[model samples]
Target: MDKEKVEQLKIQMQQWLNEAEEFINHIPPVQLYTAVGVVLFTLILLLIIRLFKRTTSNTIILTGLSGSGKTYLFYQLRDGSAHQGTVTSMEPNEDSFILHSEKDKKGKLKLVHIVDVPGHSRLRPKLDEFLPQAAGVVFVVDSVEFLPNFRPASEYLYEILTKASVVKKKVPVLLLCNKVDKVTAHTAEFIRKQLEKEIDKLRTSRTAVSDADISNEYTLGVPGEPFAFSQCHNSIIIAEASGLTGEISQLEKFIRENVKP
Candidate 1:
């Protein structure tokens, strides 16, 4: 009886296979090819979109004038402690890792690729090499010594804000005022107003020069009005941090916002 049932089941399976083959054979060559092409095209398009999203940059650039404490901030973010006596870096300090603050979390987190570009006049050109891949730029400032370095700091920031890569891509910038734990540190609001004033002055003088003579790919601010961070195409945020005391929550927040977990 078992053998007889097995034979019937085999015949039923063979009949289904034959019917399926006949149905396929009845399909016109054009219709079959079109259906296959549609499926293949859809798969290729989905694959391309996935690749594009995965390629989205995870780089965060820390840049500012010499003595602005960018290196300290970089180390603090990666190591969670200020490694003492860190002098001005001659070369770019770069690393890809999960932020030290996030390491204690339970689940897997995305690694942030951070580049601390040296702020010396000659090394400033190196910033162009990494700006293309930057998810966000943190322009560090020495809040305790801001007044003395205000002009130069603003000039450097002006150059960065005008770059074609920064402007065209609308890469967000965080005007990070570092070393705010000190007694005489300036407020982030004060530093922001001062920077806006200085950048406005720069815009005036720079716009007078012929476009060919200017290295900046795009002019900053509106032609007739005063320049403000709010007027730029890219978003500019001002925040405070103390790399020395490891009070970098704002900086970490900015990084996480730009480079998601």
Candidate 2:
């Protein structure tokens, strides 16, 4: 703190700087340039990696016709129990949270952005806002009552599979058959086959119409071939779940596979 001590420290700091400068001057120019380049490259690389990780998507979209148990599944993921009997959502129900099932896992966990888009036809367009950044999509179906909703579900699913974002980005889709807890619930295979059949019919009807009436920009499947989910550019998978009974391991698996946490 004294003036003499401060002067001594300043002199020592100057000497250190001079020594550093002299050492650098003595080094070969090529080696010095290489060292500088390496450091700058490393810094740039680290910055780029940080930006990519930050921008990586944690979003998972839940979409299906109304009463297919998407809301139930959404609550079950966030709260570990379905908040049953609530009114249907007019808009998307979204939140960033660690899955309740993963709550007991050790160490820090990444948050998942779950967006449960309303299944009503009028609200389906809202899905476009989230599809670009989505890590995955779950298309729910009311398994027990699937027959009544089959045509509409096929149309919705066709639109999703053909979306530019979904097809180009290769966004993975999980077709979920919900209400499997009921004794009369359809099997996953049956639902998949029936959906294929329905979509095949829709593909024919829609392709025959004008583009103005056709909401799908991209074609659904191979021309003159029977429609199947395997024809999709992106991965289209079938799964089953029971929101009420909490049999959702498959759904959780799909989320973890895409989100990495």
Candidate 3:
């Protein structure tokens, strides 16, 4: 071919390449915006899932009479064994939230934040503050002592239930009949029945009002009902300060099932 023809061919090829580059640069802004939007949307989705997990977790507050095993359960939950003695009140500097995480039988994660409040009658006044913070209440009862200590336990239960009801929230209650291994006749089923009877009696007494008795009346706060009542199915009770392994696991499972997350 001639040099002039070759030069013309080169010029036509250069012009074609320049036009292609300009056309590429003029591509729609919508496509570029869509690419950026996808990246931002992915980031937002991840953040929402993380926030949902944190928000849906439940917090439980354990309350019962002194020597009712609230502290024992707390220690068992923390260490996976009830080997430690009842945890005494912490110093002013210590944090109040005792958070523990354990895996369920199916390998699902279970998080529990147990607020251990003082069980003595004197500390009853402080329950108002604690009860409202908890999503559920684990009311530990000493099964062996129930016969001798029934009056005080019943009164305490009434008070707690009333206080809980006044807030217009029906929190689930787990009646942990602790120390069941000590008694020969007191099976978990038996304890459950007795407690249910006692609860019914309490409810009846509160609601029973004669026509003439309307002069003076009293009302309960919790509506004379329990949120969730169950017996501790484990046989090894009397969770000593050394450790309460068998019973604690049962209690943990019960909580995970009934307590909403």
* C-alpha root-mean-square deviation, each candidate: 11.4, 9.1, 15.2
The estimated TM-scores of all candidates read 0.84, 0.81, 0.56
Error of 3 at 102 (Å): 2.7
Supply the TM-score for candidate 3. Answer: 0.56
Sort the predicted structures by lDDT, highest score first: 1, 2, 3
Candidate 3, 91-113: lDDT as tens digits: 11112232243433344454566
Instruction: Give the lDDT of residue 211 in candidate 1.
Output: 63
Using lDDT as the measure, the top candidate is 1
At residue 237, candidate 1 shows an lDDT of: 94
Worst 10 residues of 1 by lDDT: 207-216
How big is the positional error of residue 140 in model 3, measured in Å on the Cα after superposition? 0.6
lDDT of 2 by residue, 1-261 (tens): 999999999999999999999999999999999999999999999999998875579999999999898999999889988875266888899999999999999988889999999999999999999998998999999999999989889989988987888887789999999999999998999999999998999878876888776564688779999999999888988988888877899999999999986
Q: Which residue ranges in model 1 land beyond 4 Å of their true spot?
A: 1-27, 30-47
**Candidate 3 lDDT score at position 238:** 22
- Model 3 per-residue lDDT at 1: 100
Between candidates 1 and 3, the one scoring higher on TM-score is: 1
Candidate 1, overall lDDT? 0.93
